[model samples]
Target: MLIKNYRTQFTEELTSIFDEKEIESFFYIILEAFHELKRVDLVLNPNLELDTIQLLQWETVLSQLKEQKPIQYILGETEFFGLPFYVNENTLIPRPETEELVEWIIEDLKIKKFKDLKILDIGTGSGCIAITLAKNLPNASVFAIDVSEKALVTAKKNAELNEVKVTFIEKNILETEDLNQQFDIIVSNPPYVRNLEKQEIHKNVLEYEPHLALFVEDNDALLFYRKITELATKNLSKNGQLYFEINQYLGKEMVELLEKYNFENIELKKDIYGNDRMIRCVLKS
Candidate 1:
């Protein structure tokens, strides 16, 4: 079958589930992932043909797309911060907002001229934050923790895929008392979404992403944040910094929570969409 005609059929079938632009993106993404073909290749050769086996593969992806499955999960990989990561139902697909959080950390560390620093990423699904830090900050040692063994498995693969070393730990943060070692920086983009906010989530996310990595009880929306902050107080080195990618609706509560821990130099920054998305604070020496 001609790739262009197949793309048109794929688009028509998925137009109800996703917008035209998204459908187009999925088409090209699958093309590259499955056949190593790019948009230009299709454009330059309008009659590009897919063999029977390749057509079957594309059709399988099309069916999954009809179910509103995320393209990343179907592809089993994604790119974050210019590096590749393997993802699955066990891990949340890395988001651009989280990339902003990472960029903020990298920029701050670079500006401070810090080196040989110790860093930890709590709830490191896919190890995106921890691995990226290790890859970019060659002088730093990175550690990551996740309660889900399956998620940690995927994260470990991602670390290897990115060719960066990160210590992966399997433990629930709320049940832990100490990190056993101090870190120069502690960061987390933990489960902050409230159960009540599930309706606000898209079907692709709510159905396809891991819930353990996405939600907290509404009565204790700060569950992970509070626990991690307490651990940071006891585990951060002098003048250490802490960062979080937070729920936009609870930015004020996050600030209050940090202050209660006596953290100084608090700062909350927004993502590209201008939502209050990330917070940074210091543990005073």
Candidate 2:
């Protein structure tokens, strides 16, 4: 069967479960992953055919899509910060918002003229942020810690894929008793989503994505933020900077938490959607 024909059928089948935009995105992602074809390829060569084996593979992926599995997991890899990263059920899929967090870090480093900077990424799922920074800032020493050994394995694979050296450790952020060496920068996109908001999330995420990397008790939504901030105040180098991708609903509270810890230059920035999504603060020496 022709690739174009299968895409149309796949889109129709997915439309029942996902919205028009999501279905379209899914179609494009699958095409790229399975056939090495882009949407433009389909447009230019509408009659391009898929062999029987390819068709069966496409059908299997389509079935998973119907079941609301994430395309990143389906492909077992994704692009983040212009680098390819391996992902799975063990790791949280890197998001564009987190990419923005990486950009902020790079920009700040450029302005500081700081080299050989020691940096730490808390809960570094897939090691996207740490690896990206290590790749972009060659002189920087990057370290990442996550509770899940499986996630750390995926992160290690990503670092190797990007050909960047990063130190990956298996440690629970909430229970971390010490980080012996101080760091010039600390960054995290820790679980800030309140459990009560689960219903608002799409089935594809709530059902398939790892909840251990996604949720917090509604009553303790700032749990990770509190723990990381406390550690940063003690373990960050003189004038070290801390960054976070935060829940929009609790931006003010997040800022206040940092302020109480005496972090200076606390700034809250919005994402493309104009929701408060990022925070950066400097820890005084």
Among all candidates shown, the one with the greatest lDDT: 1
Error of 1 at 173 (Å): 0.9
TM-score of 1: 0.98
**What clash count goes with each model?**
0, 0
Query: Over the stretch 30-109, how does candidate 1's per-residue lDDT look in tens digits?
Result: 98998788999888899889999999999899999888899999989999999999999999999999999999999999
> Estimated TM-score per prediction?
0.98, 0.96
Give residue 259's lDDT in candidate 2 (0 to 100).
Answer: 92
Flag regions of model 1 displaced more than 4 Å.
Answer: none
lDDT of 2 by residue, 51-87 (tens): 9998988889889988889889988988998899999
In candidate 1, where is summed lDDT lowest over 10 consecutive residues? 107-116
Worst 10 residues of 2 by lDDT: 108-117
- The lDDT of each candidate is 0.93, 0.90
